[model samples]
Target: MSSQRRSYESGHKPKCLVVVDDTAEWDRAVYYASRWAVRVGGGVVMLRVIEIPDQNQQWLGVADVMRAEAIDIAEQALDRASGRANGVAGITPERVIREGDTIAQIRKAIEADVDITTLVLAASDGPDGPGPIVTAMVRHLGSFPVPVVVVASSLTDDDIDALT
Candidate 1:
């Protein structure tokens, strides 16, 4: 076994990888991830990747502006996630932003960095109706180095109100 895995098994803080898409469901996802991280005595790393537009598109000017806006939106979402996690009694989450295909960037970051032990993702609403973000994660799952957890969108307003 790798030294890192050994260390994790010995109770070292496991790195929790969270992929944040700027969506309304993000708050619930953050809350779920924070709860799990606290349970495992792990720290969270939240990532938001800015997906570049395809070259076939003619609106390069608009694409550039959109890209910048997307990055800003992602950063704000991640910041909110981190703040919510920090509000939890035993959880602290570190946030990161990257530019590329979301799954590819996430995989590269996890492989290049040695700390991450488990990946956490929010499940798509359903099959066939799966969105681009969900498709990306599923496509790249085979290449991931650690276990992946898909948090159910089970937390309701009652849960959030309770947390507050």
Candidate 2:
């Protein structure tokens, strides 16, 4: 096993799983996760879930193209989040891409990787309120094996600096 994974599995460190999205709101989660990893001698897993639409597949080629587009978007989100996380000291972030229900994929990721000790999320504070995924996670908190930490959408640079 890799040193980081070993440390994580041995309880020497606690890995943080940060759900990343293609929005500036996710910066808070990334910042906090990176800081926590730096403090705990662990690493961060930046996960991007491509939520496939629940629509009837009438055309196979169109469905394939849509799936490809989703993958590309997910990859871009992961790459951007990775860059942000990498800026923090002592943090080496890994990216994980998944397709399906957001909550289900998150659960699968945690189950697949025993190293994850905590889940981090960035919630929207706008008029729409916290998005559906965040709401769902909140409602199903008891089902999660790892502790969940949510970052408010309104946090400013000073707030982030203080958090780090």
Candidate 3:
């Protein structure tokens, strides 16, 4: 048997990976994903993406204040998500903080983490439409590496409960 086929068959674990942010949309996504994870006997992985700003000038050994601030914001967001996840039963989800473009980071994580079998995200209805990250995934990926579950901003508590 080919190594590729072997890896493909074994790599997928009964786990769900969810992107978490400070927005209400993300909170809804996390709630639904956590419940689903509990019901399916799978674990959840929370990923927080910090988009680093483009620095125009070289900082000759100087500290990058913007990067530091971004990290702080990211940490706070992760803490909020962690607190919410505490109520979830079954498995305690692991949190990951990454620095880069959201889409790129997500793609890298999906490729590197073989345990992830599903990707859960949230989309908000704005003047432009759905959240950019969700839209990007749907547009560029064409066929995502794993099945994606998108929780909308308008989802009610009952809607989230129905996920389980």
On lDDT, the candidate that comes out on top is 2
* Model 1: lDDT of residue 134: 59
Measured over all alpha carbons after superposition, the RMSD of each candidate to the real structure, in angstroms, is 4.7, 4.0, 3.6
lDDT of 3 by residue, 1-164 (tens): 11111223544446677888656588877787778877776668888888765665786223378678877887788777767766755457888888898877877777767767778888897676777778788775565677788888888768888767
Q: Candidate 3, TM-score vs. the true structure?
A: 0.82
Candidate 3 has which clashing residue pairs, if any?
none
Scored against the true structure, residue 26 in model 3 reaches a CA lDDT of: 83
Candidate 1 scores a C-alpha RMSD against the true structure in Å of 4.7
Where is model 3 more than 4 Å wrong at Cα?
A: 1-13, 60-63
Model 2, stretches more than 4 Å misplaced? 1-12, 54-58
Task: Give the candidate order by descending lDDT.
Answer: 2, 3, 1
lDDT of 2 by residue, 50-164 (tens): 8766566677677788889999988888887888888765456888998888898888888777788889988888888786668889878976777798889888756866776
Ten contiguous residues minimizing lDDT sum, candidate 2: 1-10
Task: Give each model's whole-structure lDDT.
Answer: 0.69, 0.79, 0.74
Per-candidate clash tally: 0, 0, 0
